[model samples]
Target: MTLRIRHLRMRAKTPAGPYGADIRFASGLNVIWADNTKGKSTCMQGMLYALGLERMLSPRREVPLPHAMTSFLKNDDETQLNVLESTVSLEIENGAKQVITVHRSIKNALVDNRLISVDFGPTLTDKTVRTERRNFFVVDGGAAKREDGFHHFLEQFLGWQLPLVRRYEGSDCKLYLETIFPLFWVEHDVPPKFHPAAS
Candidate 1:
């Protein structure tokens, strides 16, 4: 089964003001091109964060990268510190014409009193069909499992299975969609020395 993103919405409450982006994608080969500091990567990261896969973006960093929504929403001015609250919503459609809306937030904390919220539903406007955060995660032996929330749902919804492959010898590590997503969503990071050649 094929999966396609219908729409994406990101919103952040900042000291200066509210900031957000609404984007729509087509079926195939959609490209987001812009000059430096135009929020191209931010948009991509927001979508990933919305799906609870931001951690996979920088797996090897000493300190895991902050949530894309909250981190970038911070006020630049240090004089008056302001806590930024952010949210991301994604709408996806399957080949069977079933549409699902997933909403994740860094501000609202309802499930398990955690700062993160992950919820989804059949349609963007329908609230009665939404799923609770507690139901999103896999619970085994009366404890939350290490499995990802959104990834598990997508796998079952699309009937796709993720393979467990070793990165190297004796490595018991598993592969995730986040690790592989970068291959398709290539972001060019040209160094200062290579700027001329890139241009």
Candidate 2:
């Protein structure tokens, strides 16, 4: 399925104007370029924010949530309102063209309800392969653990659960990576054209 998000603010919401919180997303391959501080990454962030990734948020002045460190910088309260409103619109499913829109202020738990179903646990098991590749695993959240990447440790507390996801396809696969931080995060800087065929 293809996804798209629009109208999210990092520092502040879009000004009331002709194009409030304007953004466009393209399927297949999409690349954006611009000068520094021109909201290039911020635009991408808007989509991530709408997708419900907590740590990806830029942070408001105060109001903290679990694992979220609130900004405590001293500021003139009466003259400063740092609250930011963001809108996210996305299309899910390959060609279904279903669009959903969301608008809200920043919060500590900055993730979507459906996306929040990912879980990570150390004792998870798999269907086959003898369970020897004890890579710290992630399932759905709320029902499991957070803090991804088990860090390649000795057999003391590390063990394999085998990927419940056999081939890493569909929503089950996406949930697995989202909870444990997708492998793509490490390859974010790699150009797609230069990708190699390796495990």
Candidate 3:
């Protein structure tokens, strides 16, 4: 794969202040290590969300992040702050050396959650680069196949020509990213829930 992930950013606006995290990846293998529930999963989820690939995790369009990203954020002092808005952005480059930043709103007043904005250059890293912004839709019908879809945009960016596959229904269908992604990416199952009776 010629795709290189440059950066991932998650930000939230709160009355107390802004709570956010930024992660930059190196050229080679990248590893994220943190204690349980310390946002190791959140960073991965944020990248998926920014790329409009969250549907691979669920069919529902609801935000998959925890309350810390959607409803509230806790400060270092343990004070709770109400989150007014939250967003995630991922910077990526293809084999052609084309760099673009993809951004999505988790919860915001002005932007719809289903809308994704793409910058032509590395807006997160270099402010001097003048780039055009384009908007695309996800989670709705035909998002992967339609011309205006985010996945279609991504496929063009990555120079992918998905092949037709024979489904069980005896019909040919284009192999989607959700199906191909699992070959390389594996998302862990959620921790088992507690049950008093089982225990």
Best-fitting candidate, measured by TM-score? 3
Whole-model lDDT per candidate:
0.59, 0.33, 0.87
Q: For candidate 3, write residues 21-129 as lDDT tens digits.
A: 9999999988887667778888888888888888777877688888889998777788989999999999999999999999999999888888999999999888799
After the best TM-score superposition of candidate 1, give how far the Cα of residue 27 lies from its true spot, in angstroms.
2.6
Q: Could you say which candidate leads in lDDT? A: 3
The segments of candidate 1 whose C-alpha lies over 4 angstroms from its true place after superposition are 60-68, 71-83, 107-135, 138-148, 164-175, 189-199
The sequence of per-residue lDDT tens digits that candidate 1 reaches over residues 1-199 is 6778778887767677777777888788777776766577777776766565665566442213244454553344534434367677787777777777777665544433112234445444455675644335321221112444546666666666667777767774445666666666555655454445565
How accurate locally is residue 88 in candidate 3, as Cα lDDT from 0 to 100?
95
Clashes of 1: 0
Predictions ranked by TM-score, top down? Answer: 3, 1, 2
Residue 44 lDDT, candidate 1, scale 0-100: 76
What's model 3's lDDT at 118? 94
For model 2, residues 129-169, the per-residue Cα lDDT tens digits are 22222123212333233343221111112232325454535
Q: Is candidate 2 or candidate 3 better by TM-score?
A: 3
